[model samples]
Target: MPSKSPTPGLKRRRSGIYWCATHQAVQAGFRPSVARLPYSLENPDHRPLIEANCQRLQAEMLQFLANGGREQPRRYDGTIQSLSGLYQIDAASPFRRLKHNSRLKDTYVLKLIEAAFGKRALSALRIADFYRWYDEIKKPKRPGGPERVRRAWGVIKKLRELFAYGVMAELPECERLYTILRHARFAQPARRRMVMRLAHVEAFIPQALAMGRLSLALGTALQFETALRQKDVIGEWEPIPAGAKRGADDFVLNGRRWVRGLTWADLPADLVIRKATTKTGAFAAHDLKLCPLVLDLLERIPSEKRTGPLIIDEVAGRPYAESAYGREWRIVARAAGIPNQVWNMDARAGAITEAEDAGADLDHIRSAAAHSQAATTQRYSRGAVGKSRRVAEMRLAYRGLRNGP
Candidate 1:
């Protein structure tokens, strides 16, 4: 006789435990307790175990019928895991509105939350539970490694976001838990003060070019000189939507399309670039003629070669993935004697700092950096003392004028 088909919502695992496929959770009290028990349902020796599992399944099925055959699709049992599932997958979720990169990161953090406290009911959670998880997650993943305080902080931040979503979704107990944790404080990692200088960029360029990485060199120079982010300089690969029309500019690879970076088209005229930034949608226009070093680097690329993306990974003929760009940039940076602390991303900060030192107007610097706020530009203008010196000079001049110098 042909083997019997499993029920619609349940399947037998290799360990002989029947899992509720629809619920994505094991059926309650259905797991085997004995070690190394024989799991063959066809064998007479395994009949007792099989019958017991079936009895549990039958009871649950009758209960489902008794309740008018309706159950929440994911069977929300008032657990954080169920709430997280709804938050992540529900069409009405705010999570769906997050940026592509943010969604990817939050998804990873959500997994950590699920693994740590998935089964815990929202009502049972206390603020102390969050602190305890914080202390544990901040510990190094590997023995003797540096403490993962940053990673732990990131998890806490995502958890807070999850709770906020739960409140919006109006899930049971979520609003209460969210209210209790409203004043909670978690540990934060120290602010990053590392910055890359023009000298580092200059050295990085020659070394990158020597290593046959023209794209890396161009990208580094663009970020430093134009105060553009790495994403705006090199673009990002996003998944191509199904049945979407592929345009001439679309770079399709493995079902993903690269979009929204500097292109030759953005530089409509020689020695000039005009483009809206990706993150803030701020318009950023720069005359390459004003950026001598950037001009020099641009000159090295022949006119014909500048037809497409200004930064293309020579090896793959595609724009560099963020991580790949960082890895390769490090090798060239290390060879150029740039300290490890000075990350590739610090190029924008370095540009802002340099502008501040050069006594550029705060608003002008903010515009060039495409920052929506002057405070954001000030934050990036780290280690520049010119502003203080300028303040002192103005005060002295005012006193002299009053005293008739």
Candidate 2:
């Protein structure tokens, strides 16, 4: 038999939402699930917060059973830590809407904020305090390394969101912090200059195929030719929802599912991929028929092997985990005599660069890459001299035409 909960009227779910069972009965004896408390059960400090919420729910249930009205608003203490906890747990907060990897990075910064000034009064914080904090966190250059500000910038960005959440919730301190920090300036990291060219892809594919890693070669061609993000090409691992039925295409690892990648089903007889991107939820359509590289690689795979994920680890016979995918790609890249500085991620950038260099329309590049803005696509079009050379030629020709030379 399974053990009973020591805490009544509350159950902790595998996904970490604190499920509250305390609720008043409605018509037909149906009781709705009231809340999913965001407090961490593992954090010893959150125990009191958990108990308080549970007690509040039970009290509300009793009051509803007696008189049948709405539950009262829960009051939050105005501390940085308290606000941080609320921001994390609030369903309507932007924090909840972030992609999984982004959520993890943002949470790390939030934890740092909580540890540093968690107990401090939010209203007491000023511009000077943030300036000092930023300076303290930023790393100065050592003998061999450049100065680091990216981490500091990330912290400030997350902190701003935290303050914004508080303001949205109508907290006074957050309003003050938001108002004061409007004028503060922070340094941003330099843009990346490195990009993998089609030459690199051409070299990598043959080397990867020579080493019997057909999946790596195929994914490389897809990213370079189609401008698909690495995640969109290989998919991601996510915890399986409880009681979820497994599908034929589903790749299971322990209790998790490998989802949202280029399944064989995505490619029909038309050879055009039409699917919503995982990050932006925007539709990106790429015609594989236009990509001779992808076509040639596809022909190399045996017919039976083309049934599941387009990029599969042959040894595991499953989709590659993000880290494993990088590791294997690095091994093949090294064997191909690719530089250590060149990354598999650069394939998308390389594609954008190639398009820009070829004088393709900016809007067309943005559409193909599934970018919402041309500015975003512009960022990926890195270090191309072809566009500049074309511009120079056009200017000289115009001068010649004007001067009758």
Candidate 3:
């Protein structure tokens, strides 16, 4: 006779145990003990062992039938629910390791992971299941073309990161998880950085401050000169350092809870400043030289506020959030008749361009922008420097024409 097929969810291990691998089976104050499960055929009196295990298995099956064949999914052993539970605890927790902003994105991406697999057995996930999910998410693309896929790319990448973390923490099947998560691929595009004109920035700032949008006014001013990100300029979720003198530039920004943005000490000098926390996760300070406009803006800030964050939310008495600050910037942009094509990040690109126009060398622009590679600095300063080279070539062409005649 052909070998009998094993019942669904039943599993056997080399340790001579027949595991109840069934989902949502009630225990009724009685956890399944090893004695209640099947033993190996090699055991002494193996027939009796098989009979007893069969009797217990029958009893559970009858109970499942009486209970309408479905039990509540609990945080059982070796299930995704259990994995998610473990993820929320211990020193290895993702929340603890990631910065606040990054943590927020991770939290959402993790929710997507949990929503898909939370009720499923952790040991049961396969590469095929990941492929199905990937196909489902790839259907829609916005008119912006890359934006939708860009976000999906982040989600997919972050899902891989979660599993990678699981591997370090030694969660079950982590190596397998890594392979499956990577199988779920999404493409990210090479996006061009938008640059703004100095005239557009000039028209926007005074209107923003006049409208009591202090965050927009101050943040734009700093980003335009320092070529810093909004988080680096607006002091995202950082607190003043402990037991430090107030109203002084030397006051530290070492916070107990979070410290991922511009701190007071990050801007010790008025003209040239640096950041303790940066996007690259480097501990060393990244220096930036302030222009006359940036310097003037720095001097106008209240001493009490200055001693706290490099930039503070005057109304909320906290740091300005990315969305809230973006809204304020839009309002100012509209009031100043700036085109809708502008973004806060464009200011940094414009700043790099300005450095090029002022004849700052490539390395100088690279340092001012805090970019890791000179190529990235060149990319931002492309238009200005390219034009200068063109003008020089044009001058040579004119001289050649006159001399040839």
Candidate 4:
């Protein structure tokens, strides 16, 4: 028989390398009968002569398939490429490692990663981006503030690890990215670090108490004043009173119970604040005792069968989540005529400052705050210490003049 014509169904083309579109295969060598094989864009077996050309064609094919053989979707390939290439190097890749190894929650970190990806290319990002992001985020209406920037920094640092010690060891691009982010501007305006004052706490408490939303307001205030974290507040029940001591000290609301006392025994002894396994991962739990004022406020709240959370939403009947409490605390502050500028942590710092001003020893204040280190407590007491020193100098000066020295 005459040589059989090439199979009618198998279409062959040989512009560069022999390719069989009909069979979805490509020839490895010149032989017509060479084993027909499927193509892989990423596979190294293709012996691609030009890496860029191969990558471009592979990307086009991917786009063709992704678009269902229609017109390419706008910006889809660019988004994917940006995320997988540049963003992978600058933020997303390291964020993934952080999520795996750190206490931070994946959702929070992922959100930040997405933000970074949408912000700008790693090569194009400047320190100004960091500052703008920080400022935009710190607004009362915004979801996060300096705390978020701090957490994002952690995520960014984690991203740096991919270049510092990993398969991408040869990539100098990562080092450049790190150098840029290191000088990145914060999203919020940078404030000179100042010591917190007792007046700050004294100013906020009465207003928080007057809101009639004592459970949440008092809970938040207590966390701030006592340096207790939200989790620490949620781990124990408000104490209850038995007999005539009930009205004398404790009060019942909605059939629940609470007592007014500030001691280790009255609080959850087992509570320990550590880095949260949630997003942000900033503050953790601690064994914080309520101040007397916080106890008095708690006494006014109605009791409930649920005693686990020191602060619970009476309407929702659930423990206070930090985000929700933060929003609610702002409302309470506004209603109580307090400036909206004060934050929960600021309140805690204010308490420390107040104690220092009152001559409380640094060690005692540190213990009361349950601070892990003395230096952190000292930050709160710095103003008090400075004032004390000035007062001593003045006393000496007056004494010397009186004695005609």
Candidate 5:
């Protein structure tokens, strides 16, 4: 069995956060599960905050419990160190429930945060401090500066996202810091992720397939037609249920969901592609447009084949793997004279961009793109990224008569 009583005091460590030994002892005596213990976490920088927060806080906690008090929210005076400790204790707290995967990510990012400001008072660091840290990340002597900045920016973004007054309100100073950080841009020189362009769809992949790289071309072709993610390409499909609110012609493919992707048995009767969710922080479901090209591709699937990846690598005897899919794409792309920068995954981005550019109804794009919210399509942009670099010229033709050409 664990020690029933810990030494009575509050201590701060390099990783920040102060601990109350007395409160811990009290909790151990109370028989609360690890997830339930009311941790007396505080912060006093690298020094001790209280020689014995254990005695006083422990007494207060016990008295409250004895008086039939509800579960006290784990909190501490606002300090980065204290906030860090509270973060751990409250991880399993009811008010701030986090899924296992999300908690794991929080833990990893917390490590980076603790290393930088664990022992410091969370308020001691100003918003400018974070900005300065981002600056250092951007100018790192080593290579991969862009990636480093991106990762660090992600940490800050998560911090803002996770800051909730209702869940963990003890960190006033931390809250203030987040509020300040929110107003500022944390990263610079926006990094552009290249995707396919809309206008090139007609000639791109047909040229690739003509070059005789079947698997890669087919994989690219399927993504182009359906706007399905790479994982969905090899995942299952199934029709919507009989009693649900769907058209008789409407079908739902076995979708890649939050936790798992679908398989062969999930194939639906019709060609509706409904990805229950997407990994890209949004969701999408699109009825395959009845365009001739799209229908032609679907028709190619053997009628007897009721399930499995819509696109396949028959040579592998399983779904086409992502690596092989990308590798073959590069081969096909090179011979087809496609630019090296365009990615196999860019098809979805290209399709969404095209759908928006073509003035497809907003709801149509939203359903097709699986946007988590309707307004998400507002960022759905198109046209060349290089338009600014090109010469600007405008020629307006009047309704009936124009200047001689």
Candidate 6:
């Protein structure tokens, strides 16, 4: 079903350790250990180094195999040798180039593993050691907070996967650290909502505008009105040229006005967002579709002398970060007398509710939201209708009567 990797070999020279085809073949599992010389006797110091390098190499090789290394040539032998030296496991091997995508994530995991178990051979690490490291990291601190601890746990989990592969490949002992931790997991309490009235939405928009936070105000209002994600607004916005031909920059509002719209249209339609992007690379136009109200809001935004971003910081005219925008939202909400129930995601929920109340079909709402799954659309539609107290009461009554109450 698949082609096999060529064998790996190593060469021992006075200058440094070099790979030979014979050793390569043995390392790749194609040849027996008898094919390579017994380093245990001739180079006593080299034996420990070689063994340690072998463990690390085995881990990297397994990962390479799992990833279906068809995209890149198999170069695990050189990479393992280099990483071993870099981490101070062995310094005799030449440095190797790391695959660009794997380099960042791998480096982060390796560093964390090393810090937790300093100078310990990769083979010597136990499940308990990993647990100890995780426990130490989870300790509450004044500056770092729970978020930092979560990041550490995530890195540890990824590293564990890498190491576990080596263990499975017979290079090292398998440690069930993550499984042990899972059994001790505690359930986090759900957050309670403090509901506020919808009229607060109207008040917030004006205040944000008064304070020169038009983008924040309009963005938040638009989200509530259209059920668009925050990234849909801030990340994606094309400026409507003062006077230009219709293109990606133009949008139709109220069946009359031609305006620009904020949308993720620039991104590849199939692009999956694994992380946040900065203002310079923030919005992709391809992932967004603008509603009429969103188009109207964009038309109202002053395009004259607008340079940095369509959505800018109220105080500084710089592009707004999600966190900064979130903070501004709180301030605007408080100013609008909605000190409670002003959540970031509530806009999306509210829009769904509004559409459902207007008797829009599930398919229509799903298309508007750009949801891929019909189940997700069903969930939103069900939640939107069931959220009303009157509807809930009616449903309960209907169910009771149907059950012969």
Q: Which candidate is the best by TM-score?
A: 1
Clash count list over all predictions = 0, 0, 0, 22, 16, 20
Error of 3 at 213 (Å): 3.6
Runs of candidate 5 with Cα error greater than 4 angstroms are 1-108, 140-149, 162-169, 185-193, 198-219, 229-269, 279-305, 309-340, 356-359, 372-375, 384-405
Q: Residue 302's C-alpha lDDT in candidate 3? A: 73
Query: Model 2, stretches more than 4 Å misplaced?
Result: 1-75, 140-144
Tens digits of per-residue lDDT for model 2, 45-155? 666556655654455455545555543333468788778777765767888777656765666577667766778888677798888888777776555665668877777
Q: Write the per-residue lDDT of candidate 6 for residues 49-136, one digit (tens) a residue.
A: 4443344444444444455531123232312232223332212211123322244345445544544454555445456766666666
TM-score on alpha carbons, each prediction: 0.79, 0.78, 0.62, 0.48, 0.55, 0.46
* Candidate 3 global TM-score: 0.62
Worst 10 residues of 5 by lDDT: 31-40
Error of 2 at 348 (Å): 0.9
Q: Write the per-residue lDDT of candidate 1 for residues 257-291, one digit (tens) a residue.
A: 78888887787667678888989898998988788
Would you list the rank order by lDDT, best first? 2, 1, 3, 5, 6, 4
Residue clash pairs of candidate 2: none
Model 4 misplaced regions, further than 4 Å: 1-172, 179-189, 192-210, 234-290, 301-306, 381-391, 394-405
Model 4 alpha-carbon miss at residue 174, Å: 1.6
lDDT against the true structure, per candidate, is 0.75, 0.78, 0.60, 0.46, 0.52, 0.48
State the lDDT at 249 in candidate 6: 35
lDDT of 4 by residue, 253-333 (tens): 322343222223344544333433122334444433334555566556555432444555665665442245667767766
Q: Write the per-residue lDDT of candidate 3 for residues 1-405, one digit (tens) a residue.
A: 211333322344432344352334433322231221334456653444354334434454545455576432323376664565455433556656665556545544555555556677757878776665665555456454533555556656765766676787777786788887766555664576567878987888888778877667767877886677677777554333334345533322222122355666666554445454368753333334426656666667777766556666566565554356777678789998998888777887898888888877778677667777899878786368645776898999999999996
What TM-score number comes out for model 5? Answer: 0.55
lDDT of 3 at 162: 60
